[model samples]
Target: MIKKAVRMKLYPGLKEEYAKRHNQLWPEMKKMLKDHGAKSYSIFFDPETDYLFGYLEIEDEERWAQTANTEINRKWWDFMADVMETNPDNSPVTVDLEQVFEL
Candidate 1:
C-alpha cells in the first residue's frame, strides 16, 4: 500500500459543519473509497487556520486517479463545494504531502 496526504483550505467559520459532514459521511462514498483501494482514510482540521488535512492509503495510484473521475466522486465533490475550495470540476485543490518517516 502507498500512503498519501493532502491539504486544502476550508471556508471560514465552517469548522463545525465540516466536522458534522464527515462524521455523517455518505455510505456510498465510503464504499466507493474502499472499492477503489483507499484504506484508513482520515481528515484533520485546524480551526485556527481553516486548514484541512487528509490522509489515506491506496493500493494503486492510477486506479485512485481514475476512480475520482466517476459519477459518485463527482457527486461528492458537488456536495462539498459550498464549504471548501474546489476547482471548476469540483475537485478540491490538493497539496500533496511527501512522507519522510515511518516506524
Candidate 2:
C-alpha cells in the first residue's frame, strides 16, 4: 500500500461540527472510499491552527484519486464545504505532503 498525507484548513470555531459530520460519515461514502482503494484512513486536527491532517494507505494513487469524483464523495464534499476551506467545486483545498523519512 502507498501511504499518503494531506493538509487541509478548517474555518475557525467549527471543530465540533466538523467532527460531528465525520463521525456520522455516510455508509455509501465509506464504501466508495474502500472500493476506490483506500485503507487505514485517518484524519487529525490541530485545534490551535484549525488545520487538519489526513493520512491513508491506498492500493494505488490513481485509483484513490477517482474517489473524489464519486457521487457520494461529491455529496460529502458539499456537506463539508461550509465548515472548511474548499474550492469552487466544493472539494476540500488540500496540499499533499511529501514523505521525507520513515522507519
Residue-level lDDT tens digits of model 2 in 4-63: 999999999999999999999889988998899887899999989999999999999889
Residue 103 displacement in candidate 2 (angstroms): 2.2
Per-residue alpha-carbon lDDT of candidate 1 for residues 13-82, written as tens digits (9 for 90 to 100): 9988888888989999889988899978989999788999999989999988887788988998998999
Q: Measured by TM-score, how close is model 2 to the native structure?
A: 0.97
- Top candidate on TM-score is 2
In candidate 2, where is summed lDDT lowest over 10 consecutive residues? 61-70
